[model samples]
Target chain A: MEITDIGGVLCNGIKEGKYGLGLVRVRGSIAGVFTQNKIRAAPVIVCEENIRDGVVEGVIVNSGNANAYTGEQGMRDAREMCRIAANLLGCEERRVAVASTGVIGRKLDMEWIRKKAPEVYSGLGNSVENAERFGRAIVTTDRFVKKAYSEKARIAAVAKGAGMIAPNMATMLCFAFTSAKFDSGELYDMLRRAADKTFNRLTVDGDTSTNDTVLLISTGKERVERDVFEEELCSVFYSIAKQMARDGEGATKVFEVRVDGARNDEDANLIARAVASSLLVKTAIFGCDPNWGRIIAAAGYSGADVDERITLSLSDGRDEVFLIDSGRPLGNEERARVLMEKAEELVIRLRLEKGNGKGFAIGCDLTYDYVKLNAEYTT
Target chain B: MEITDIGGVLCNGIKEGKYGLGLVRVRGSIAGVFTQNKIRAAPVIVCEENIRDGVVEGVIVNSGNANAYTGEQGMRDAREMCRIAANLLGCEERRVAVASTGVIGRKLDMEWIRKKAPEVYSGLGNSVENAERFGRAIVTTDRFVKKAYSEKARIAAVAKGAGMIAPNMATMLCFAFTSAKFDSGELYDMLRRAADKTFNRLTVDGDTSTNDTVLLISTGKERVERDVFEEELCSVFYSIAKQMARDGEGATKVFEVRVDGARNDEDANLIARAVASSLLVKTAIFGCDPNWGRIIAAAGYSGADVDERITLSLSDGRDEVFLIDSGRPLGNEERARVLMEKAEELVIRLRLEKGNGKGFAIGCDLTYDYVKLNAEYTT
Candidate 1:
């Protein structure tokens, strides 16, 4: 497969101190997923339109201003972004996908974007440094830029987002590029499945964003086995999703919950998500308390209807304790406390004595800084 | 009406230092509202049955341990608590309602309860001191015991609860006493409606507890108009609900959200509840930020489909600002900021220009203190 690292793409800032604009070129067909939130941003709308043709040359993305709810002007700005990217790449405007993330309810800085278009275009290069710039350009409130891929397969992706999480449709900007050949329909199906298993299962603050988008672009420059490509893409997406969860707004550490032997996958998922998204659960983890009751309570309210036939366990990779067995407390208070205090990779496991359906969710502990970071000043 | 406060109520600690047991002696009829959570506690089950005949002498309540998820032993303990109260109050066993609120899943200290029953009964007195002791006896983590009453109608109530705030059936313990005459049928009907408008509309932390119960009692010692009784009872219940909302775990301010002019009350309630229960909205209120976007976002995702024809306003009793008008910002940033910073009672008003239906919810802002109070230690 003729795979190339995304080294040299146009990346710049429409606003100073914030990398708010970027364009990455790839010769391929396009497939994508959009936010399930009915109130979508203008860029999400544009991305949907551009990808309809099943052919895309690249993607143009920005942060700092999610062009959503800015009325008709928001639509115009999104279209103009694609137009600019198309001009720079010498492709049809319909071939350039667009995405925007950050502060919602504002119009994009089209005037600044227009003025800096030439500069960003001129800076395109095919180096790892260029690709790293793409990483740096897409962040919003994210402490670190996240990228994942299989070097052997040349499937690389960069993602940006931390809060407003509870992704119904991967609420963030994620762009993946692959040199492997695949039809648009095939790529779309693969992306949709991978995203559901990964991004859709994650939640941070439980505030779904207005602009959640994920795009997979296959250059068709080289052919690869479908199963291998799917596996690699899913791995990369899952990795990025984990990073987003860990970097959740004011997050202290990653917390993973796995519900096993539920009545079904949906019930397992509901149980896992309930525990992961519970503020009480998050705070308990933050406090380093073996408050397994909160976990069980969350599960009880999840509508899973597992009755009292379940076991709850907690660990920090080293210290592990089964806090509840079949709705009964194990009463290993000291060991549970020790496990909770470790603060690294907290794992909550729930085993329902039903059928063997299992599901899991990755999230982060809630912290005071989360409140400070997201809601300190009136905007 | 022969007005009398809840005096001559036997109250004592089931566990030392935690005044967690009580029996109120009132020759009255009782009606109650319970939690909607499918996972109900033993006390709830007992109360449901005991108060079924509409004849009740008093309530036996315990704090420091919520008798929920305690299995068969829990049910027996709750029944035994009622039996003891019935014996002490000189009434049938079924005439005494039971409630326990504190930590869930742990069985009550039955030995302590049985031993202390005689002391509590012996010390009962018809004095304000006795009534206040009843208030002090039924609290879990509450900083203040909440009470509301109308002296003229001889109606009064006491309640206790703090965390696990979201309630399909208000998860706290509320026991109301009245001298005004009303049958169980009428009392039940009135209590149901009043509780729905009051207790059922309050949320904090969004965790519906397994044990939430509210009971209303009448001595049938004097006759009163149904309208007067209903009005006074609703007002008192609403006042108590407001107190609970304000005192939510670690809340700094009471948050009231009103949705008016919706297609129907159900939709209106959906919108109001969505905003009230939102983590972002609560956190924003906590930070005193006039971040109206979070409010609109919450409403947008509330399945309300409110298009661009809605108005969102925020006020703190006096200061007010129309933040959004028909999906457009009013640009009254300073006023909104001023209104938010007051930190006493924050009211978010949403007006949909669709119909005249209206609904409201009372909640509390999410605070770091709430996390500390609810999740500091493992059970």
Candidate 2:
């Protein structure tokens, strides 16, 4: 297994504003997932086509503009990006996936991109700095860098997204590389399963973006067992997903939610994601108010099979206590206050007593800073 | 036709710690609409039973507790409220519809409530002060008193809500009265039609509350044609609903939205409400972004049939210009700025060119004040 130094070029482009871009090359089969929003960005469309052949050699990410909603010209620009990357990497354009993230609706500056492609290619080398650069280049409004490495040091991932997107689908960007033996189909099935329980369950805001995407590459340089690789992938995705929730635009703490004892996984997820998406619950956590009624109310409206015979509890990653038991308030203000006052993480646990199914989702508390950060710009 | 002074009593209850409550008695056939949430509040449950007889002589509101999710005791407390109001108003308990709004799940302070019922009854009179009291008493976190009197001087209405509740349903409490000659059937039909285009279109924080109700009463003293009364009711509800949006918790302005040229009324409403309920669009309006892309994106995801052939415009209730023409940015910053800068109200005009059916919805911008007001407490 080898690392590449090309990530620095991608990082440099974003920092310099010459072009918001990044690139990483791997000799492997690749699989990907894209946003479900009907309105698709040009690069997302480009990536969709390039991944069809299953053999992917590299990934190129551009920032500064989303290259979305630009009509036909936008499509041409995205294709040109792949063409440029292919030329530099000495691979077919179809084997290279390209992604763009930034403000939506603006046209990409291809002239600047054309000039930087060769530089990013020359910068490629086997190193951790290259991976870090790749992570830095993909960021949009993210407050912190999110990347993870597997225990055996064969798998690595970088992700960037701070704004709230959606449940059931992603509205951010992610890329993972592994020196594990797998075909595109095998990798895609595993990636989708892992994502459904990871990034897909994380919501920042309710708005779904047009540029969400995730790519997984199997470099085949090392032979890790499938089960172990899956475990590592899930772990890495969890860490990055948690980071995204923690660094949610203007967020102060990560809000972790678990919905348990439901009739099925779907019901559990429905309630858990609904609780995560609720601005009232978010703000309650933000203000240090352990108001479990809001949580129950949100669950009631989640289209899940919820009744009065449910219990709700809150914790600060340590001490936990039920605020509502069997649909009645169990007042414990002192313990709740101490738990809610945590500055890093807040946890909500729900038990429905309806079934054994359970699900989890993460969100950030809504704060004045969140509104300020998101509302100040026109994007 | 006459105006009563009982409003002051209602308003006073809200102002003092005595109650966030109101009661208005009229000799009429009454019709009502309530929230569709499965987790019905105790007061909502009681109102549902009373509104059935089609002979609502009075409306008794008890504030300070929502009387929701409080189990059997909450049910008893709500019925008891009607029992007390029936005794004081010289009517059967079934003749009075009851409503409650405040923090959810706590038991009603019946001792305090029993002490205030008689004072409220004694304070009732035939003056505008009484009507003011009724309006004031219904408020929870409302920053303004909302009331409307029809131009014909035969109809008056009062409403209170500052958050989003339901789409096909309501999330606020409103009471309206008329001396027009109509049966409960006619008035209910009129009220439902008017509300569908007015209150149903208004959105705040997109969180559906468990307790939401609207009641209309007819005194049968004056004769107005059904069409005319419907028109009048629509106008009154529009005015009050606009005020609710304008004063939404900490909202700064009423964000008005109009969806036109749709395939059907449902499609138009779906698109319009989607635009109104979007946090991204709300935050943009609050930030004075004039970012039309967010509006288009929201419409696309509204579960309505939409394509590239649509036009979007912004206005400040007067001057207006296109932000997107047939899915392309119109690039008119100057006009958009003036329209978005209006302090009182801003408008979004959509032309889908799909058909003639149109729809309207009202919402408030995402602002720091909303977070501050809602986050400070656990309600």
Candidate 3:
């Protein structure tokens, strides 16, 4: 798989990393998934319409002003973006997908797009620098660029999201490219299944956004076994999802909640998501305090079929400390506290006695910087 | 309608208000509501069982340890608490209801209870000071006393909760008394209806506690009109609920999100609760920034049938500013910012174009103190 060309231009011409226009030129069949939010952005709507035919020539994404909730003007601006990108890339207008992320309910600066689209297209090239630029261009409050490559499967993926994240998608924007041969139907199914297990099980502040989009384009340049391809695809997605959580607004650390032995898969997912989305649990992690009661309470209120015969433990991948065994406190305060203070990556393991179902979710600690970044975002 | 007798004893023998035992000895028919969390506390289980016969001669409450997930020993401790209270108050053990709040999975210090329960009962008296002590005794992290009285209907209520609050109940604990004559069935119905509208529509940290309990007792001393009693009962509950929001852990301000013109009441409620529970929205309010996009995005992803033709406005009771009108940005930034900065109590009003359904939720701003308090709660 290969990214034939990619480039980014600062649409607002500030170069302060605030506003950008990204262009990725490739010939492939595309499959995409969008935010389930009822009030989708205009760009998301246009991309949904464009991707229906399972063919795409390029992608145009802009940051700094989300073309959302701007009424008819927003829709027109989104389509005009595609038109500009298609005209420069020598592709049909309906074949060019468009995406935008930033402050919601704002109109896009059409003049900047009209000027930068051609410049970005002209500078397109296949290089690591170009990939980094493209990753940087699609971020709003993100602290770092997110990119993942699977050498074995020849797949590359980029993602941008910091806040406004929750299960079932968020304000997250992700794009992947591969030269492996796969039909659009197969690509769509694979992407959906992979995302359901990765992106759909992530939370940051528990606020799903209005402009979340993920696209996978197969260039059909090589052939690989379905099992190998699916495994690599999932690995790429998992890496990007972890980066999204680690860079969550002002996140200092990222954690994963794994639930096992639930009554069913649904119950396991519910418990894991509830714990990951709980503010109390996030704050406790931020403070490096082993407050297991909040975890239990979150699980209890998660509408899952939970009972008293549950076990909870914490780990840093190497060392493990049991906080509760069979729903009884083990009072391992000192060891748990030390693990929390020292762990680079934390994992909370909860095992129920109901059945053999399992699920997991990734989340970030709620820090003061998160509040500061989001509170002062639009101001 | 009257306190009859109320008192509190320092259970842990520390006068700094860390722990206390509260006893309210007023014979009446009782109606109660408990947390819907699956892992109910031992005290919650005891209360549920004792209230089945609709008789409550007294209530024994403790702060600092929640007898939850303590296995069989916790159940025995809870029953023993009721027996101790009943023996001291000269009431049947089966007629005494018990409630507890604070850390989960900790066994109650039964020694303190056996020593302090009689002391608290002996000092029982019908006085405002006694009521204040009782209120203080039931609080864990609450910042101030929460109590409300209705002179017209002879009703009084007290509540204790600051964090771990959400819709469908929380870590909140409330007790109300009235001398008005009402049957247990009527009282139960009234309390449920009032709580459904008031306490059930509030959010602080969006974490429902396992020990939330509310009790309403009616003594046969006065006879008020049914309509007047119900109206006053709702008013009292609303007052207590508002206080709980205002005193939310580390909170400096409280706000209400009012959603109107939704497709149905359920949709309206979903939207209101989503907006209120949004951390981004709460932080924006805390920063005094009118980031209306977060509000709109929260509404969009609330699983409600919302559209772009919604109007959003902010008010401080005396003044109002519209941020969005009919899906168009009004750009009233300066006015909205000033209102957010100056308003003592803020109200966010959203009008949808679907139907005539309306709902409202009360919430507090997210602050650094909230994170600090919860992070260090168990440590």
Off by over 4 Å in 2: A1-14, A165-171, A204-207, B1-14, B164-171, B203-207, B261-264, B353-357
Q: What TM-score does candidate 2 get on C-alpha atoms?
A: 0.93
| RMSD, candidate 3, Å | 3.0
Give me the TM-scores of chain B across the candidates: 0.94, 0.92, 0.94
Model 1 C-alpha lDDT per residue in residues A171-213, reported as the tens digit of each score: 4888888878899999989998898888878842233567788
lDDT per residue (tens digit) for residues B1-379 in model 3: 3243311211111112577788887777899987878889999999989989998888999888888888899999999999998898788998998998877788889998898877787777776567667877888777786888788788878888776233423378988888788988999999988888888887322345788898998876788998899999999989888898888777777899999999998999889988888788888898899988889988988889999999999999989999999888899988999988988699999999999989999988888788777667665
Tens digit of lDDT per residue, candidate 2, span B82-194? 99888988999999899998887789989877887887887766666766677778776776667886857377777777654222122478888777878888878988888
Of the pair 2 and 3, which is ahead by DockQ? Answer: 3
The TM-scores of chain A alone, one per candidate, are 0.93, 0.93, 0.94
lDDT of each: 0.76, 0.75, 0.81
Ranking by DockQ: 3, 2, 1
- What are the per-model DockQ values? 0.44, 0.46, 0.61
Instruction: Score candidate 1 by TM-score against the native.
Output: 0.93
Each model's TM-score? 0.93, 0.93, 0.96
Candidate 1 residue B213 Cα shift, in angstroms, is 0.9
